[model samples]
Target: MSYQDRRSPDPLRRRRRTTPRQRALLELLKRDNHFRSAQQWHAELRTTVGVGLTSVYRILHQFAEQHVVETQRAEDGELLYRLRDTAEHYHNLLCRICGRAERFTLDALEHHTEHVARQYRYADVNHHLDLYGTCPDCAGVAQQE
Candidate 1:
């Protein structure tokens, strides 16, 4: 039998199946909160899910648009992504050693941002902030040695 005929003849059946690439991507992101580049994620996914680099990039972009993932810019300007902990605007306090993250918001910063935007007549202002330190567990481990 030909490839098409050999497979499920029902097109709807195939369409109903979840996109494995997307599912795999979400699972990976959910496992960690560290901001990482698409290539960093793709490297891990490639080993387990065989997802392509381009596909990973595309999926991440879609997640960003949907607000399913938070996006940040790396020091070099490459966009990084992490699974968002909140539906509202937030920032992160990141554990440098373990990559754990705690979500937070600064009302003063938010107000200032808005005030500056209004002063300049800019619309739709947005911001990002991340704080990093060695987490308690990691620090304790170091002390024991």
Candidate 2:
């Protein structure tokens, strides 16, 4: 099938109008508490907002494109989606063993990022760094065991 055929029918495709379902999806993503799968989000919509799966996907894609939510692929290759914090900067540390994630910021790392970008002659550089190691709690648990 063609790409247009794959997409849902849009009568007001020319006009950008936010439906109630879209608003609910945006609000749900803005809460920023837990990671949710598409299926889980669909169930929540059914119980709470009465939106369909197709609408959920469409709204989610819109939100992701607009930076309303952030999407990441987990170590197991699952596409996980989370709400984006507009006010806070985001960086992640990953536990290579347990696939756990932590957030942190360091002024030294920020300076290094800028320095490397400048040295490499990169323009408009934005970077993401994911440090991989066992977390302190995990290391302690391993030692105790």
Candidate 3:
């Protein structure tokens, strides 16, 4: 009930501003165009920001749903995320260790899928195709080891 108590900020509480955190997470993503698990992103963010792990997962989920980021499954089935390179539908050749990606499109595959869908009378058919390998830089590093 003291007059000065209400005017002072709460020292024990950590402020969590939504927009800044979201933008900070985004800035982190922009630093590299490489896919990583949410846990990985959170661990990296911890060194630079005060974002919580739950917030990291939630923000990444929101970005995925909005198509602000692209996601793919790693070899062990963990979901990986990266900033989307384009608005169009496409696939990528991903590097398993380094997360490097090269976006690609296959017209023959698309046509074959469409034909198969029509043959089976399936509507709204879609597909996901990704190739995983080691990029040259990672391979060279491995060779040196």
Candidate 4:
């Protein structure tokens, strides 16, 4: 059978049935732990997979929703995608220059949030923490100036 014929008939409806292009994108993201924009990924994959930009975006969005990929905003405000390593709640220390991420959990912060919520009688509380800064390498580069 042709490669296209083997792809899922309806990617939007079937979560389990992914197109070959989507599978390729997932594999690429899995191999690359660093964050990349949809445009970057599309540019890289076009030469090898012949996938379109819209397909790249659709697949990335679906992966993000399924928790297979994590999304973060760059310094320029463009959304970037990376492979998710775990399902546990955590925060990220992201590098503004190279898009490196260090995941960490703050138990004290969580406790404080819960305490404050209880004091305010709030329910269904959740939080998202993202700390962005230059990494040591980036800082060193800046220092040399």
Model 4 pairs whose backbones collide = none
**Which numbered prediction scores highest in TM-score against the true structure?**
3
lDDT of each: 0.70, 0.61, 0.76, 0.76
TM-score of 4: 0.78
The C-alpha local distance difference test score for the whole of candidate 3 amounts to: 0.76
| Stretches of model 3 off by over 4 angstroms after superposition | 1-18, 141-145
Candidate with the larger TM-score of 2 and 3: 3
Worst 10 residues of 2 by lDDT: 1-10
Candidate 3 lDDT over 30-134, as tens digits, reads 898888999999998888889899999999888776556778888788999987645566687889998888877889988998899999999887777878899
* Model 2 lDDT per residue over 1-145, tens place: 0101123333223326788887777667656445566766777777778777888877777766655555555556565566654425556666645445677777787789789999999976665655557777768765545
- TM-score of model 2 (CA atoms): 0.58
Which portions of model 2 show Cα errors greater than 4 Å? 1-17, 30-32, 93-102, 131-145
Model 1, global lDDT:
0.70
Rank by TM-score, descending? 3, 4, 1, 2
Q: Can you write out model 1's per-residue Cα lDDT over 80-101, one digit (the tens) per residue?
A: 7887545456666766554556
Q: Which residue pairs clash within candidate 2?
A: none
User: For residue 56, what is the lDDT in candidate 4?
Assistant: 96
